[model samples]
Target: MRLYTKDEIQHAVRLNTTVIDGIESAFTSLKTKKVAMPPIMRIDIPANNGEVDIKSAYIEGYDSFAVKLSSGFFNNPKLGLPSANGMMILISTTTGEPQAILADNGLLTDIRTAAAGAVATKHLSREDSRTVGIIGTGSQAKYQLEALTHVRPIDQVQVYGRSREKAEQYKSFIEKSLNMRVDIKNTPSEAVNNSDIIITTTPATEPVLKAEWLNEGQHITAMGSDAEHKQELDTNVLEKADLVVCDVKEQSLILGELRSCSNSKLINQVHELGEITSGLKPGRTGYNQITVCDLTGTGVQDTQIARYAYQQLNFKEDDYNE
Candidate 1:
C-alpha cells in the first residue's frame, strides 16, 4: 500500500479556485446521491480541552473512498505543538482493499475547510468585495484568507484575536504574503465593521461577532462551530439573515451556527449549499441581502480532497496491492 507523509501531503495540497470547485462538486454529489457520507462521529476529551472527530465518505463509481480521523487539542500550542492532527485512509472499491494512507495529520482538512469558505464566499458575497474581517489568528485564520483571496479582490484585512502578539504575527503574515494592509482591531466588532466579508475561525462557545454589528449586503462565513457547545456568531444574527445557508442541513442543526437558534420555523428555512450550487436554489439574489454560510466541514470534502491528494502524487490503485 502507498503511504504519504504529512510533508508530502502539504506539498501536494494547494488552495485555488479548482480546489473550491471540487469541494462544491462534492456537495452537489452528496445532494444528488452520488456520494454517501455519514454524520461526523466525535469523542470529547474535555479534561484536556480536546476532541477527536471521525468522518468518512464514498463517491459513487469513484476509484476510492476515504476514512478520516481528525482531532483537536486546543491547549497543545502552549507546549509548542499543533492543536489538531489526523490522517486519512483511501480504500479501493474496485478491489475492496486498502489503497493509500495519507498521513496528512489534518492538513487536508484545513485546506478543504478553507476551500469551502472560498466557494461559499464567492457565490454569496458581492462582486465588488475587497475588504475581509477575520476573528482568530490560528492556522485556520491563515487558510481562510488565503482561500478567500482566490475568489475575491481582497485588498484590506481586519483582524481580531485573543492575543495582540498573535494578531500582530498574523498581520505580518498577511501583509507579506497577501500584500494587503491589515487592521488589528481591539474587538471583533471593530474588525467586523465595514468589511465586505467576515470570517470567524475561533472555537468560542459564546458569540464573538454580534448581530447588530452586521450591515446589509455583507457575507459571513462561520467555520468555528463544528461541534456542540461551540458558537461564534450571535443567534440573533442567524435569525436576522435574509438568506442563511449551510453545507448540510442535518449537520448544521446539530453543531453549526443553527444549533443556537430557538425558532424551529426559522431553522427550517435554512438552505443547503448544494441546492444553491446545483441551481436548484438561488444564492445572494439581492445586493442588500444579509447572507450567512454555516460550514460544518463535511466528510465528502475529505473524500474529494483525499482523491486530489492521490492524483497530485500520481498514484495508481494498481500500484498499491497486497
Candidate 2:
C-alpha cells in the first residue's frame, strides 16, 4: 500500500471550495442511508492530559473506506510537539485490503471540520452575510475563516482569544492570507455583536457563548464540544435557536452541544446535517432565522477527505521491506 505524509497530503488537499463541496456531498450521503458510520470511539487518559479517537465509515457502493485514529495531548506543547496528531488508513472494501496510509497528523480532520462549517453556512446562513466572527486563535480558527471566505463574500473578521499575542498573530495571518480586515475583540460578545456568521472553535468546558449574544438572521457553528465533558455554547442559546442541526444525531446527543439542548421545549425536532444536505429537511427557512450547527466531526468526512487526497496524489507503495 502507498503511504502519504502530512506534507504531501497538505499539498494535495488544498483548503478551497472544492474540498468544501466534497464535504458537503459526504453529509448528504450520510443522511440518505448511503453511508455507514459508527459512533466515535474515544479513550481519555486524564493522567497524560490526552485523548484518542477512532472513527471509520463506508459509503455505500464505494470501492473503499477509511479508518482514522487521532489523538490530542494537551501537554505536548511543553515538549515542543503539537498537541494533535494522527493517521488515516484507507482500505479497499471489495477485497478488504489496505490501499493507502495517510499520516496526516490530524490535518485532514482540521480541514474537513472547517470545510463542514462553510457547507453549513452556505445552506443555512443569510446570503447577504459579509462579516464573520470566530472564537479561539488556533489553527482551526484560521481554517474556519478561510473556508468561509470561499463560500461567502466575507469582508471582515472579528476574533477572540485568551492571549493578546496569539490574537494578534491570528489577526495578522487573516489580513495577509485572506486580504481582509480582521478585528481582535476584547470579549466574545463584542466579536459576535455585528457578524452575520459566528464560529466557536475552542475546547472550553463551559459556555463561552450566551443566548443573549445571538441576534436574528445570524448563524452559529459550535464545534468545540466533541467530548462529554467539553462545551462551548450555553444550553439556553441552543433552546432559543430557530433551527438546530448536528453532524450526527447519535454522537451529538451523547457528547455534543445537543446533550445540553435535549430538554428544551422550544425545539421540537433535531435535524442532522446529512438530512438537511439530502433535502429531507429544509434549511434556513427565513432571513431572520437563528440557525445553529453543532458538529462533532464524523467518519464519513474522514473517508471522503482521504479518498479525495488519494486521488490527487501519486501513489508510492515501495515501503515493503519484507
Candidate 3:
C-alpha cells in the first residue's frame, strides 16, 4: 500500500474553501444519483480520561471502502502530544485489495466538517448575509472561517470562547488570514446576537447558544455536538427553526441536535444535505426564516475525500513496498 505522511496528505489534499466546494459537488453528485454511498459504521471507545473512535464507510460505484481511526487530545497538554491522531485507508471493492493509505487522522475530517458547513450555508443562509459569528477557537474554527468566506462576502466576524486569549488569537488569525475584521466577544450570546450567521465548533456537553439569543432570519450551523450527549444549542431553538437539515438523517437524529429535541416532537422536519443539493427540497424559503444545519460528521464524506486525496497525490499501492 502507498503510505502518505501527514505533511504529504496536507499538501496533496487541497483543503479549506476549495475543498469545501469539491465536497459540495460530491454531495450534489450523490444526490443526482451519480454516486452511491453506504451507511457509515462507527465505533466509539471511552477511556478513563479520553476517547477513541474507529469509523468505516463504503462508496457505491467507486467500489472502495475508507476507514478512519481517531483519538481525542484531552490529555495531550501534559503528555506534550497532539490531542488528535489517526489514519485513513482506501480499499478496492472489486478485489478487496488495499490501495493507498493516508496518515491524515483528523486533518481530512476537519476539512470535511467545514465543507459540510459551507454546503449548508450555500443552501440555507440568506444571500445578503454579511456578519458571521463563530463559537470555538480551535483548528476546526480556522477551516470553518475559511469555508464561510468562500460562500459569502462576510464583512464582520464575532468570535466567542471560554478562553479570552484563544478567542483573541483566533480573531487576529482570521483578520490576517482572511483579511476581514474580527471581534472577540465576552459571551456566546453576544456572538450570536451580533451576527447574521452563527457557526459553533466546540465540544460542549450543554447548550451554549440559547433560543432567546437568536433572531429571525439568522442561520446557524452547529458542528460541535457529534456525540450522543453533546449539545450546543437549546432544544427549543430547533423548534423555532424554519427548517432543519443534516449531513445524514439517521446519524444526526442519534448524535446531533436532533437528539435533544427528538422526544419533544419539536422538529418540524429533517432533511439531508444531499436532498438540498439534488434540488428535491427547498432552501431558505424566505429571508426571515431561521435555518439550522446540524453536522455530526460522516464516513461517506471521509471516503470521498480520501479517494480524492489519493488521486491528487497519484498514490499507488506499490509505492509503499518499493
Report the C-alpha displacement of residue 186, candidate 2, in angstroms. 0.5
Poorly placed runs, candidate 3 (over 4 Å): 16-18, 29-47, 263-265, 315-322
Give model 2's TM-score versus the native structure: 0.95
The C-alpha stretches of model 2 lying farther than 4 A from their native spots are 264-268, 315-322
Tens-digit lDDT string for candidate 1 (195-216): 9999999989999988899999
**What overall lDDT, based on C-alpha atoms, would model 1 receive against the true structure?**
0.89
Give the per-residue lDDT of model 2 (tens digit) for 246-280: 88878888788987765745445878888888899
RMSD of each: 2.8, 3.1, 3.2
Error (Å) of candidate 1 at residue 162 is 1.5
**Candidate 2 at 86: error in angstroms?**
0.6
Expressed as tens digits, the lDDT of each residue in 53-172 for candidate 3 is 666666557777688777775778789888788888889989989888888868888888788888899899998889999899998888987888788888899988999989888988
Q: What is the lDDT of candidate 3?
A: 0.81
Candidate 1 regions with alpha-carbon error over 4 angstroms: 315-322
TM-score each candidate: 0.95, 0.95, 0.91
CA RMSD (A), model 1 = 2.8
CA lDDT of each prediction against the hidden true structure: 0.89, 0.89, 0.81
